[model samples]
Target: MIADLFPHAQPGAGLIGGVMIGLAAAIMLLGLGRIAGVSGLAARATGIAGSGAPHGIAIAFILGLPLGACIVASVTDWKPATYSAPLMLVAAGLIVGFGTRLGSGCTSGHGVCGLSRLSWRSVVATGLFMASGFATVAVMRIAGAL
Candidate 1:
């Protein structure tokens, strides 16, 4: 119905998702007094690192990601994207993990939560990551790999 009502409204889904993320971040901040950084939470959950929040909370938060995705998949007519190769997927995951560690946060941490609070570190990190992403895409396109 929505797709039919607005044939070109592709941004609607993204906008809604962004708003939901912001709300979740805000709740984490205001209610729990913690930054909703997924990388940090995951690290804490796995005993790789510790944040100010308890490990149990972090574990629950980490678990909620897939649970939420599953719920959304059940209710919505959405499908996950497929990659060309399993090796490529593993490589991408490794790169992303390295990047999150290097940057000290992921996109959700810096782009959504950090930027909202006007953190200079996050601003610089987000800008650098965004530029790096664009450059990566450009290079991939030139190499006919994307």
Candidate 2:
């Protein structure tokens, strides 16, 4: 039904991805008592930040991201997108990293964990993130940059 409504969309993929993400988040929280925020994990892994989960666990989790994706892609026959602009991609990643630090947490931490726990800060941060994203897309679209 969703496929019929949106011919180019892969509805099942999103449902599956969301379920996997939720399951991973649940496991991280329940088993490790840690918030599944990639930025925080990266920071911890790189010794840029401290507290919460151990550095080793953070490093393992960071490494597991691509490994897990590879496993999923292998099992599902899914292909990830290839970015044409490597430099732009790297710049974007750095900007996002800085934003996450300024915001106190990334989407995974704030949107999933913090919001789930009804944190006001997460609520505001997530709202700003979404709004900023929307605005950026709109500006890019208007400038024919996308």
Candidate 3:
């Protein structure tokens, strides 16, 4: 099973991955009384919220994402493969924001916590999320955009 996941699996990578995820979720829930739904947090930061945590903390978490990636790269041999230009990245962010509003939650909510709770809506939302991602990748590849 582990071999199926990574042909060149590094020792303790799976354990480290699971620990990181658990720590993130636990910290979010414990400190904020909210799920670490990245999309919801992003929306709130961009003025789409009624009330929430101090904007600074949310912004910090958002900013820390890239910082954390850089830190990992510093410690390991990892680097970002490729990404869109600034304008395209902005457009993608807007589209993602809109989609999260339409979908009522992000992957962390629907695909992680809600699904764990056996929520039917979550099940459907997760399915749609996966399908849409697959479709997007396929369409982009077909158009030579990937």
Candidate 4:
């Protein structure tokens, strides 16, 4: 489906990205005893979370997200993906922030870390996340909005 949409199926890039993510998560766990959850890190970075990783670390991690992308794009033929209008982007971000709070963590936390650790809660949460994503896409497609 992605190839259908973009025609550029970069499996090597996916592998590289997956390996990098796993390394980052592993480093956070083994070196810092923290789960590499972007949502929690974001909250911590913004002082919304009262307690968690150090503020500096959170800020660095959050900043590294886009910075890393920029670095890669500089070296490789990587083009930043664009979504919708600014208003829609902001609204989607707010909704995702709320959903991350409601769901207890983002995909990185529950889907990768929690699932790897055999957490039943994460399993359920990830399942619901996938289902909701599918449903949303289905609805959007039906409405000719996808």
Candidate 5:
């Protein structure tokens, strides 16, 4: 279905994206002494949480996410996957927001930045993250939602 929708799918795009994410995380860590976690950064930007970096920086980082995506989409003939309903999208966002808070960090922080530093907490968190994601997909598949 996806390939039918976007025949120009380039598998190398994932590798490129991963490398770009790693580099961005590295830069944030080394330059600002901060973890490049979207959830934490967004929270700080929205004044929901406190962090070492200034709110302005957090806001910039948050804004950059969509800006970067737009730039990529413009350059590459990449099309985003569409979903069925807006309400379901909002519900999914709320669930992800809750999960990020409950987990104490998002995937970028734990899976990418934390694991890179060899943190035990990050390892466990990443494992749980993957497992939960797999379980969610399995459940969704069984429910004929995927």
Candidate 6:
């Protein structure tokens, strides 16, 4: 196991992950003046237009996520797992969209970008998002719907 292989490790993976994400956010903010907010991009992509910066960067970011996954799969002998069903996936998407709108931003926005700026609204939203997620998972596990 990965954990077993690095028993004396100092969370290098998490550190690298945070550094990479910070670099991405910094690059986006400095180079494009964008907030790296996913909800803003999703809104623009769906024709809700508030800021065009998030729209463009969000488009690139969203598209690149799957592309990166594919690249990893191709190079690392990773076999992707299939989802339960197309309808379930669609329902999940709708629910997530609703949650994003209600929460004012997605996790990437509120949790990462917003929290980085020490925004109170973002902190509340992130807390709510996380709590809701935890509740959902716990309920689903209890109901055997997980």
Name the 10 consecutive residues with the lowest summed lDDT in model 1. Answer: 44-53
Q: Can you list the residue pairs that collide in candidate 4?
A: none
RMSD of each: 3.3, 1.6, 3.2, 2.6, 3.8, 3.8
Give per-residue CA lDDT, model 6, range 1-146, as digits (tens).
Answer: 65699887758757986777778778778888777777677677666756565455667876776786688678876676868678978988999888787677887788888899999999999888899889988998999977
Give lDDT tens digits, candidate 4, residues 16-35.
89989989899989988999
lDDT of 3 by residue, 36-80 (tens): 777777766777775665687778777877888788889997767
74-132: candidate 5 lDDT, tens digit per residue: 99878888786999889989998988877878889999999989999999999998998
Give lDDT: candidate 4, residue 146.
75
Please give the clash total of every predicted structure, in order: 0, 0, 0, 0, 0, 0
TM-score (C-alpha, index-matched) for candidate 6: 0.77
User: Which of candidates 1 and 6 is the stronger one according to TM-score?
Assistant: 1
**lDDT for every model?**
0.88, 0.88, 0.80, 0.91, 0.88, 0.78
Weakest ten-residue segment in model 4 by summed lDDT: 3-12
What does the lDDT read for residue 99 in candidate 5? 87
lDDT of 2 by residue, 14-59 (tens): 8888888889999999999889998899888999886757988899
Inter-residue clash pairs, candidate 6: none
Instruction: Give the number of the best model, judged by lDDT.
Output: 4
Q: List the residue pairs that clash in candidate 1.
A: none
Kindly report which residue stretches of model 4 are placed more than 4 angstroms away from their true locations once superposed: 1-8
Clashing pairs in 2: none
State the TM-score for model 5. Answer: 0.87
- For model 1, the superposed segments whose C-alpha errors exceed 4 Å read 1-9, 50-52
Give the Cα error of residue 85 in candidate 3, in Å.
4.7
Candidate 5 lDDT at 116 equals 89
lDDT of 6 at 54: 43
